[model samples]
Target: MAAEAIDRAMGALIGGALGDALGMPTQLLSPTRIAELYGHVEDFVAPSADHPVSKGLPAGAITDDTEQALLLGRILVSSGDRFDHARWVNALLDWERDVKARGSYDLLGPSTKRAIDAINDGVPPEQAGSSGDTNGAAMRIAPVGIMMPPEPLDALVAKAAEACRATHNTSIAIASAAAVAAAVSSGVAGSDWRVASDRAVAAARRGATLGHWVTGGDIAARIAWAQKLVRGKAEKEAIRLIVDLIGTGVASQESVPAAFAVLEVAQGDAWRAAVISANLGGDTDTIGAIAAGMAGACSGLSCLPQGRIARLKGIDLAEVRALAADLVAARNAKAGSGKEAAA
Candidate 1:
């Protein structure tokens, strides 16, 4: 229940990385093709050479989903937990350049790439993300949420929105990020899955008010529908329904709802959620990362496998744990400052 509980924070960061690695091989592939090739993936698998972005990635190798999330976490820690859109944009560009220099083809998402390009072409950083409406913001937002506690849903939504501002400024995108962040924050505070879900929805609705100028469909309504559709269905059927009706594509409208549905079907089991998401086909890594991150926040480090976490590449668990702690400290201190001022 304490913000200092490293287990939940570790669970969130490592769980998301594990999910990204598990789903990397199947990302952007069709469900039918994934079934034909891997036949119910239960563990980490090498990405096929077919997808150019993920080619040459070994088993247990994480993709941009985890990489960008870690980058965001580091940015948060370095900035004293402040959410600065310009700094976020600059960090992402630097990260992309570094990744490219390393000869890795796994690169930025379409929305993000374009936003950054626009920023480079003389557009202000704040104005660059206006065109973005993808789930890129929500995919890496667990760090922001993990640093927060249960109360003050408005501040959580605001921080989530600010985190999204670098590449996804639309209402749906911001709201989706808020939902994921709120879920993780509530879960880390020891709330049950049902309570976390309620907070997620409420925070999303509250975030939408902050984005009144940005046009998009209602994330809250979509998540509500997704929750209903997967309520009593079996795993396979739930996957089918999520893919067919809710969708699992790269768009915020599709992936965010699908992630929530996947988490619901898994009933807050972090490992099961990751497994389910890895086999769900389109944008598998991002969906798995989002769902598993939330489930991890709820279940903590105990639910994840140590062997698998040990095999994950490009991440240092100890460093991530430290950053999570620093973020918690920074946020609490800010909250305390606000309370003192209020008095």
Candidate 2:
């Protein structure tokens, strides 16, 4: 159990990195083009921006998936073992808000990048996120599940939804963020994929506001539908359906559904999931990153390779370390508070 716990945690981080780096080269490839270019991006290579790694990343480097997740991890440490929404939001805001020191170019999704740009221009933070519906929130949300306080799953889901407002605020985006966070947390708690999936869907359902663009039903149903659509269909056809049926790219509609669909495809194979995620075309890196993180959280770290971790860029490494340290600190604080989840 201990080993499994560790591995699941490792899965989230390593899987995220693998997906991000692999998709970097083909960030904008159409599903058909992706299949033609590579059956699936299986290895770590620095794809030129036009190629895949083009999201302003270095060879063998990941994107905001690792960076933002690390930020959440660091805040969890400061959270004293439980969530403090303000602190979490502030942490994310600080990192992305101070754009003078930009993270890797093209690292942040358009919604988040635009929202931050709005905040810098004097828009209130709350209003800043109103327009963002990109996958930015979903892509970097894994750490919240990894180390959140153990308690009411519903409340945690709400928190996750609200927490994503630093960048994303649309109901669909918020729900997607909650799903990823809840799924990761369920994996941490040793639940199976179905349990995790149920919790994730339930969380999204709860967080959804009336008249929200994407229904909980839409997100959940699409997973099954994408699988059926891809059956005997060419890989390109599968990718197209993901774009047409589920969406690809950064829109919350595209990101969350695409990630879930690709996740279903990856099933239990860490490498296969990550590779296919990138190959599904639109927002390939983001989809791959989210699925990969979920895979890591559900599986164990042993399923991933150490070489990939070593190959990630130095900046990303430092960010993840900070997040991990925060996770440990959060546990310690919870212990001191007499309510640590570990107890």
TM-score of each: 0.95, 0.81
Q: Model 1, 225-296: lDDT tens per residue?
A: 898899999999999999899888998889998989988999988788889999999999999999999888
Query: Best lDDT goes to which candidate?
Result: 1
- Model 1 clashing residue pairs (backbone): none
Q: What does the lDDT come to for candidate 1? A: 0.83
Error of 2 at 138 (Å): 0.9
**Model 2 off-target regions past 4 Å?**
1-4, 35-40, 49-58, 79-104, 149-151, 210-240, 315-322, 328-343
RMSD list, candidates in order? 1.8, 4.1
Q: For every model in order, what is the number of clashing pairs?
A: 0, 14
Model 1 alpha-carbon drift over 4 Å, by segment: 1-4, 212-216, 338-343
| lDDT per residue as tens, model 2, 188-269 | 6677655676677777665566123533345544544554565565555665677777777566656776776666666645
